[model samples]
Target: MNEVRHFWLGISCLIFKVSKTFRYVDTDNELEKQVGGYEHIVVRCPIKIVDENIVETVQKLPRGTIPGDFLDAIVVGMDMLIKKFGSSNKGKTHLCLITDAQYPIKEPYEGTKEDQVDIISQQMKAHGMKLDCIITIGKLSKAINQKILAENDHLLSQFSRKGVAKMRHVGTPTSLLGALRTRTISSVAIFKDEKVVQGSSEERLL
Candidate 1:
């Protein structure tokens, strides 16, 4: 059924802020209640899925690890989710990526982060997946935050500038409630197979 959905939610937390991320999600609130339908991947550089149980997964994340890059974690975790769950039929396979948009100072990944973003955006468009980021900004001014968000929107939209990618600002737990409430899964893109359509007669295959 179109109403039924599966979510691949990822948590990208910094070393010091890891507990806060868990606490926010672990709260007896709508977030926890709604997350039962999702298979969560916890990424703090090294990633693990607590499988179907969201609360237990949050509790089990190791503490005291060195701070790692959230961007790298998001890309890697998303890749895993897409490979494992992507499908051609929009009704059967609907993918949504939810993350807290907290970027670390230094990127731990070997390849260029831009390349990863570009590839991820392209794959998302091809597979018709939706991505939403609840941004948690610290110390940055309002002007800077807006600049970053706009840049991210452009980057994630690829060339099409479609509404498949979304971002929201959430500084505190209270703000996070609003962020969680705004995320609706009904807006997922419906995919069409281009390979089924042949080229025009004028086009020659050399």
Candidate 2:
């Protein structure tokens, strides 16, 4: 019998959805079928943040900030996945990062954006993981900003320079599903940057 491939999937969404749309659920189900035979761990982005200080705890997180600290969230999710799934001997675990931000990351604390990207890229290379970023354009077609596209392109270029493949531009669930079914992808750790990073950028096709 042929050995099944393995994958670690992590998905992140900026806008809190009060309800999952038809396409959203359909895309998730389709992705499950596509990876049915593989040993895979699926995780959603923005792992819960809990602040504990002796006598108090906080779970609520504020939103609507420039270049939100989303990379940190992604890393948290990836770490959980890694801990659950044993190391892969294949030299590379697959990661799929789904995001809707056009500019979602920046350089780590005391580091430049380029430095942060390089560090994350190197770390993934060390861990034998490959990443594929799926970006979802804004739902508001009328108010879509040009800066968003520019930022999105820059992000894709940065990842490509670091050796990721099939960085795709998707606007809807159908497009996302089409890309996932046709391409192979993975993800890397999100590092903390010195300042809020900005850029412009996802999907559920698969």
Q: What TM-score do all the candidates reach, one by one?
A: 0.44, 0.49
Question: Against the unseen true structure, what C-alpha lDDT does each candidate score?
Answer: 0.34, 0.37
Give the range where candidate 1 is weakest over 10 consecutive residues by summed lDDT: 189-198
Error of 1 at 121 (Å): 0.1
lDDT of 2 by residue, 1-206 (tens): 00101112232221111111223331222223453311112222232211122001111212222333334433433444355333641233444555555443444557765665666667666666556666665354444455854764675557678885346667664564455442222221221110001121111212
> Model 1: per-residue lDDT, tens digit, 44-146?
3222211223333333444322332333334443444444445532322222232233223233245654566666666666765555544444454443456
In model 1, the runs with Cα more than 4 Å from the true position are 1-65, 89-112, 138-163, 182-206
lDDT of 1 at 93: 24
Q: What is the number of backbone collisions in each predicted candidate, taken in the order shown?
A: 0, 22
Candidate 2: residue 116 lDDT (0-100): 57
* Model 1 lDDT at residue 145: 51
- Top of the candidates by lDDT: 2
